[model samples]
Target: MNRWKKEFSFILALLIVALLTACGSNGEETNNEQASAETEASEELTIAQINWAENIAVTNMWKVILEDKGYDVTLSLLDMGVTMEALETSELDVSLEIWLPVQDANYLETYEDTINFSESTWFDNAKVGLVVPTYLEDVNSVEDLNEHAELFDGNIVGFDSGAGTMEVTEQLIEDYNLDFELQPSSEPAMLTAIGQAIENEEPIVSPLWSPHSVFSNYDLKFLDDPQNTFGGVEKIHHATRLDFADDYPQISEWFNNWKMDDEEIGELIDYVESAEDPLDGAEKWIDENEELIGEWVK
Candidate 1:
C-alpha cells in the first residue's frame, strides 16, 4: 500500500510539471505575437507636402488619420520639383496633391517610371488660369489682358517662381505678347495682394486654380483662355514610391478609394485656414466626416 501511494504522488507531480510547461510556452508565444504587432503598428511613413492651401489641408488630414491608426507619420514641406525628385528616389513615401495631365504633366513624365500614381484622382474638374475679380468688367478674357494691361498696373500676380503655373504663365506671356510683368510670389502673398485689391475695388490679374478656398471667399472669374495655354480640367492625384504599394497594400488601397467633392474639399480647406493649427482643423473635419473616412479605412 505504501509503495502504491508513493507512485500515485509521483504521477501527480509529473502532470503538474507538464501543465506548467505548456502554460509557459503559450505565454511566451503570446508575448512574441504582441511584440510583432506593436512593431508593425509603430512603423514610420513620410509624406511630402507643398504650401498650397488644398495640399496643406489634405496632407494634414492624412497625417492625423494615419497617426490615429497607429502609424508614425511625418509631413515634409517641399516644392513640387523637390517632391517629385524625392518620390522618384523613394526618399518620400507619398504626396497627397499632384495635379495631373496639365499642371504637373512635366513632372509626371519625368518621374512616371519611378513613381506610382494613385489608381484614381481624389478631386476632378480642377483648372488653372489667369483670374480676375468680378468687378473688372472690361477684362473678360486672356485676349483682353493686353488691351487693358495698363489697368492691371503692368503686372500679372503669380504664385511661386518655380511653380508649374508660373511656367505656363511665362509661356502665356510669350504666346500673347502682352505688355505686362509676371510677379512671382508665394501663394499667401498673392492671396494677400488679391484681398487688398478686391477690398479697394482695384483691377488685378493673377494665376489661380479651382478647388481653392479663394474662389469660395471672393467673387472671381477665370479669364477665357483662347490659347488654352493653361490646359483643360486637371485632376488632383496622390502618388507614392514605386514599391510603396507593395509594402503598404492597405494604405495604397485607402488612397485608391478616396474621393472628395468640391463642397467637401472646400469646407475642409476653410476649416484648416480658420483654425490656428491646421491639424486641429483636420481632426475636426474627420470627426464630422466619420462615415466617409470609414469607407476609406475599412
Candidate 2:
C-alpha cells in the first residue's frame, strides 16, 4: 500500500508542474501585449508642404510648433498635383495649402472619403488678374485694354505656356475679342520685362496672382474683369489624411489651430521672393510678429 501511495503522489507532483508552466506562458503573453500597446503609443508623424510662399511659411510654422510639443515630425515633398494624391493614399499625413473651389475643387470632392479638411482656418485673400503698371489708367479694364493692344506691343505678357492661368487668359482673349497675342515665356522672363517697363514708365500687362507681394514691390494694379473670367477671390487651405486624426492628434490640432493674416503672409512672401530663402523668411516673420505668433497659438 505504501508503494501505491508513493506512485500517486509522484503523478500529482508532475501535474502541478505542468499547470504552473502553462500559467507562466500565459503571463508572458499578457506582458507582451502591454509592451506592444506602449510601442504603438509612441509613433511619429509626417507632414507635406508645397513649394509656394504661403505654404512654406505656414508649414514651417506648424513644424516648429509641433516639434516644440514633442512630436517626431518629418517633412515630405509636394507638387500641385502630387500633394493631393499623397494625401488621398495616406502616404502623407497632412498638407496645409489646399485652395478650394478652383483647380483643386474637383480633387477635393473626389477624395472626400480619404481625407478631411477644415474650413474654419480657411483664408480668402487670393486674386488672379491681368495686371498692368499703376501708371496705366487707360487700361483699367479688360475692355479698356483693346484700344491699347498696340501700346502693349499687341502682346499680353504671360508666364509658362502650360499654366492654368494662361489657359484662362487664352479663353479671356477669345471671349473679349481682344487684339493681342498671349506672349508665353518663363516667369523670370515675364518679370524681367515688367521690371524694365517699370523703370522706363512704359505700359506692361501680364497674368498675375496674389497673396504674392508683387503689388507691394512694384506699383501695380489688376485690370477689372467684368465678366469674372479668371474666377473669384478665395482662401488657400489644408487637407490631411483620415489617419491624421488617429496617428497624430496633437500635431493635427496644432496645424488646425495655426493661421496667418494676408499681410503677415505677404511680408514673408516678399522676404522669400527677394532672397529665395523661404524658411529663414518664415522664421524672421515669426520673430517680428511675436504677438501675432502667440495669437495664432491661442
Candidate 3:
C-alpha cells in the first residue's frame, strides 16, 4: 500500500507539470496572435498629391516614410479641385497640402463639414500673389504691376488654372483695375517660363507662393498685397477624409503630429528638384533626419 501511494503521488505531480507547460504554451500563442493582429491593423493608404513642387516634395516624403513602416502607399497626381473632391467622397485617404484661410478657402468652405482639417499647420507664413524677380527694380508690389505691365509683356503669368491663387488673381486684377492678362498655365509651365525669363534677364510676374524653392533658386519677391485680397498669411494644412482617423488612426496621428517649417520645406523642395528621382531625395532626407522623424511618429 505504501509503494502504491508513492507511485500515485508521482503520477499526480507529473500530470500537474504537464498541465502547466500546456498552459504556458497556449499563453505564448495568444500573445503572438495579438501581436500579429496589431501589425496588420493599418491598411494600405492612398494619398492624393497635387503637382505643386512643395506638395510633391512633402507627399513623396511621406510615401517613403510610410512604405518603410510596411504600409503600401499610392500617390495620385491630381489638381486641387479634384483632390478635394476625392477627399470629400472618401476616394482618397489624405491630402498633404491644403493652403487655408485664403488659397484653398473655396474648397475648404465647400467641404468643411465633410472632411477633416488638421488643427495645426505644416507651414505658416504662406502668402500668394504676383511674384517678380528681385532684379526688377521698378516692380515693387501688386499695385506697381500695372504700371510695368508692358515690361512683363502685359502678362501676369499664373499657375494652374484650377489653383486657388489663379482664382484670387482674377479677383485681384478686377479689384486693382490692372490691365495685365492673368496667363493661365500649369505650375511647371509657369516656373519654366519664369526660368527662361530669368536666363534672358527679362521681367516676369506670376502668381507664386512663399515656402517655394523657386524663391531660393532665383531671387524673387512677392508683390505685396495691400488689399489683403490674397488673404494675408495662410497655413498649409493636412486634409483627410472624415473616416481617415478611424480607418488609419496611426497614420492620422502621424499627420496631426507632423510639422515642417518653411526652411525644412524649402530644403526638401530643393533636394527633390535636384534629384533624378524625387523619392530618392525624400529617402535621403529621411535617412539624414531620423531623429526629427522619430519625434513625429512618436
Candidate 4:
C-alpha cells in the first residue's frame, strides 16, 4: 500500500509540471503576438496637404483609407512653396496636387533632384487663369480686363502669395502690361469676394482653377489667356520625397494607379464641403465607392 501511494504522488507531480510548462509556452506566444501587433500599429506616414479644395478632399480621403489599412497617417497643411521644400528635405511623404508644366514649374525645377513625381497624373484637365462672373458680358478675355479695370477696382484678387498659380498670375500681369494690382489673399477670402460680388452683380476677377467646387457653385468663366501665361491645360500629379517609393512600395503602387475624373472630384469636394469634419465626408465617399477604391488598393 505504501509503494502504491508513493507512485500516485509522483504521477500527480508530473501532471502539474506538464500543465505549468504548457501555460508558460502560451504566455510567451501571447506576448510575442502583442509585440508584433504593436510594431505594425506604429508604422506611420505623413502627407503634406495644400489648402486648395481638391487637395483637401483627396488628402482626407487617403488619410482615412490608409488608417483603415493599419497605418498611422498625418496630414500637414502647408503652402505650395513650403510643401515643395518639405518634400525636397524628405520631411513630407506625399503631396496630392502638384500642377505640372505650368503652375508649379518653378517648384519642380527647384526640387527635381530631391523630389519624385508620380508617373501617372491623378488629374489631367486642370487649368489655372483669371476668372470672372458670366454677367461681365464685355469681359471675355484677359485683354478685356485692362479696358474695364475700374469694374474690378483695378485689382485682380488671387490666392495665397505662395501658390504656383499666383506666381503665374504675376507673370500674366507683367506679360500683358496690365495697370491693375494683384491682391494676394487666402482661397477662402478670394471666394468670399467673388461671392459678394456676384450677389450684388458687381464685377470681380480672380485667379481660379478647375476641379474646384467653386466652378460648380458659381456661374464663372475663365478669361482666355491669349499669351498662354497660365500655360495650357495642366496635369495634377502626386509629388513625394525621393525615397518615399522605396520606403512605401505598396502605397506608391496605389498612388500610381489613382485617377479621378471631373465629376468624381467635384462630388468629393461637395461632400467634403458639406460635412462638418472633412474626414467624415471622405469616409462617406469611401463607403459608397468601395469597389472603385478596392481596385487601387488591391
lDDT, candidate 4, 1-298, per-residue tens: 9999999999999999999999999998999877765665577889998788888999999999989988899999999888888888888889888888899899888888889977689889988889999989999999998889887889998879999899899999999999899999899999999999999999999999998999888899999999999999899889899988767777888898888889888989998889999999999998998888988887
Write one digit per residue (lDDT tens) for candidate 1, span 1-298. Answer: 9999999999999999999999999999999978865775688999997889999999999999989989899999998888888888989999888787778777777888899877589998899999999998888899998888889888999878867788889989999898999999899999999999999999999999988999888899999999898999888899999998766777888898899999899989999999999999999999999999998887
Per-residue lDDT for 113 in model 2?
Answer: 79
Per residue, candidate 3 scores C-alpha lDDT tens digits across 161-221 of 8888889889999989999888887888989999999999989888888888888779888
Cα-based TM-score, every candidate = 0.86, 0.70, 0.86, 0.86
User: C-alpha displacement of 272 in model 4, angstroms?
Assistant: 0.7
| Inter-residue clash pairs, candidate 2 | 98-237, 123-235
TM-score winner, 2 or 4: 4
Please estimate how well model 4 matches the true structure, expressed as its whole-model Cα lDDT.
0.89
Give stretches of model 3 more than 4 Å off.
1-42
Instruction: Please give the lDDT score for candidate 3.
Output: 0.86
lDDT of model 1, residue 258: 92
Clashes of each: 0, 2, 0, 0
Q: Which 10 consecutive positions of candidate 2 have the poorest summed lDDT?
A: 36-45
User: Which portions of model 2 miss their true places by more than 4 Å?
Assistant: 1-49, 72-78, 109-115, 153-155, 159-171, 177-190, 271-277
